[model samples]
Target: MQRVLSCFFALFLGLVPLASADVEVKAPDVLVRDVTNEVLEIVRKDRAIQAGDTQRVFGLVQDKVLPHFNFRRMTMLAVGRDWRNATPEQQGRLVDAFQTLLVRTYSNALTQYRDQVIEFRPVRQTAADTTVQVRTEVRQSGAQPIGIDYTLEKTEKGWKVFDVVVAGVSLVTNYRGSFGDEIRAGGIDGLIRSLEEKNRSLETPQGAK
Candidate 1:
């Protein structure tokens, strides 16, 4: 669970943007760094968020974080080949449930932020490149720095993140096994129910779960 949380948090932390990365190829890398920096400051200053206010944290994530992500793509990648097996309705539900699960799971983890510094590794991609990897490192107090990388694709609106890698673990790959198991046990609907139940548990008070 700790590992999963760390990976999820790393996804957001790695998604921030940097103001200095003005070039097109480096845009996503810069964008994620800047956004992460902005979010860290918000977490550092907002008392309500620090106190585990789910609404406040969710609002921040929905407004500031979701816009930069390609949730459908992430969901599909996480589902792997099984994505094609699901009906359109199931795919939609899976996307929604998965997104909610991530939002609920990682929003509270934001409060753990405490002066963690992010360092962006240099990116080398041409303007014509449609996909790229933006790499970074998170330096935390009393802990070894962890590597966080984003896999983003260029779109009409901007560069949007579809996958994340934390400490060499691929976010989509991390869930592949569990997702497969759920689908095997109860089909696509089962996976959706599992995710929905998990989200509900997160919404519940600690005493309930």
Candidate 2:
């Protein structure tokens, strides 16, 4: 698993320490804690996990992460020029499959959450534009703290996190080029097939190890 993903998971694996649950939730703190808590609450009790109660990890990922993401925009960015050629149905399937792939990836990496702590940096703003960067630090006991920044855009409902940058790498940027290559190699269906194939090989993340 990638360090960025691992670091973020360690900070937000959702298992409330019980003692920490009653404390008042606040921003930077709440942003990191709440999302992690929401993710953990469902997976801890889910029976679908492969082992150590990881079966329902994918569902939990979809429920929590998907609600705050823009799959359509993600797909469009990933598909690049191929987006104009795909039919509405094809576009929909591609979005669904891509979403599944992401969920599975999260499920597989859930166990990477270790005994790490998180600190959210203040929201940075350079302009009045609707988009801004929200940053956080994932702190480890004996290791360096990893910086993870969420790129958020204002939506009709509220702020939605569209992309994540860990270290210097952008999750959306990393996948976008590859997805575009897939479209170029096999067309839209081929990309969809690739996503489905990867999802099939998914290993359920279990235990807290």
Candidate 3:
């Protein structure tokens, strides 16, 4: 009985970290350095970011970060099978909502920057001109290290991140099941409502920010 209980508790703790674990992500030399340095500078230099002006900070994210990411793919993945059901207009709305949610999320995350050190690894790219993986490590003061891996696809403009792996888990992949649950329950609209509620909570001053 005691052993079984202990095993269950251990499994729960593992899930805690696994669900939101900030793994030490490693990136390629120049790319990792450039990204970390840019974010760090924004944290240090941006007045609105320092002041917790999330609206403006998110505006910056729209300009700076969003351009580097692949929102269409991300949106499609998040919406899951609902994608097949939605009209083009509904799909567009879902994409916009998710993009806003992510931009605001990064803005908030950036505001929490105390001091994080990072190490970049070599870039292992594929022969095809379509994809590449950039890895990096985020070292904090006293917490377990976080690993971040960026999966990039080459576009006409430049490289765009389609997925970000925190620890070894893919962010989009992790969200899929939960998102699917919402889609199953409330459909795409339900998922949108949930995301809106979550974003609203972020706008409020409180926990785990």
Candidate 4:
């Protein structure tokens, strides 16, 4: 699971931009392919990101990739039944914490890129379809290729990614169990604190750690 998550991050390095003028009109598959190539090139040349400058990576992610994700939907899915129980304010906090966790995870993953090749598979969709899965494989030297799939839905703004499946394990599902456990232990606030703490730990300087 850990290996899949790590490799998924390296592949994820490419799917960051929705700010492009034509992205709104592009098909989901094209969007993924084009953005993947575009961002991979950026990562390859950015010395700061290559040198492990997490702040730069974080900013890049915040500015580029985050806009394309449906994070509220992601938090709701991960929280499951507990989502309805959370007050609006609690739900808002949960979304913020969850987004922070992913942003930090992505920052760490961005630094681990090693020229892994991404192969995007054909996406099957119809004009009536509202949701579609974009399948891709990450190929690295001396290792088997890993499958990474993105679940996206067409929205008013554009196509937004709601979940990612790594090696057939859904990212939201992976977190759901742990999130459920935390909610059971201390309620929603407990889960929030737990996520916040995790984010803080990730934020700590390496020298301090």
Worst 10 residues of 2 by lDDT: 15-24
Off by over 4 Å in 2: 1-3, 6-51, 125-129, 203-209
What does candidate 3's lDDT look like per residue over 1-209, in tens digits? 22222221111111111111122232223444555566565466766556666666555556555655788898887667778897787788778877776666665665555556666777766557467777766676887666676777766655567777777777677678888998889987888788878777767343225
Top lDDT model: 4
- lDDT against true structure, model 4: 0.87
Root-mean-square deviation (CA) per prediction = 3.6, 5.6, 9.9, 2.0
Which 10-residue span in candidate 1 carries the lowest summed lDDT? 16-25
List residue ranges in candidate 3 displaced over 4 A: 1-29, 46-48, 126-129, 204-209
Pairs of residues at least 3 apart in sequence or in different chains that clash in candidate 4:
none
User: Cα miss at 71, model 4 (Å)?
Assistant: 0.3
TM-score winner between candidates 1 and 4: 4
> In model 1, which regions exceed 4 Å deviation?
7-26, 204-209
What local lDDT does model 4 show for residue 147? 93
Give the range where candidate 3 is weakest over 10 consecutive residues by summed lDDT: 11-20
Task: Report the Cα lDDT for residue 61, model 4.
Answer: 82
TM-score of each: 0.88, 0.75, 0.76, 0.95
Q: Which of 2 and 4 is ahead in TM-score?
A: 4
Collision count for each candidate, in order: 13, 3, 16, 0
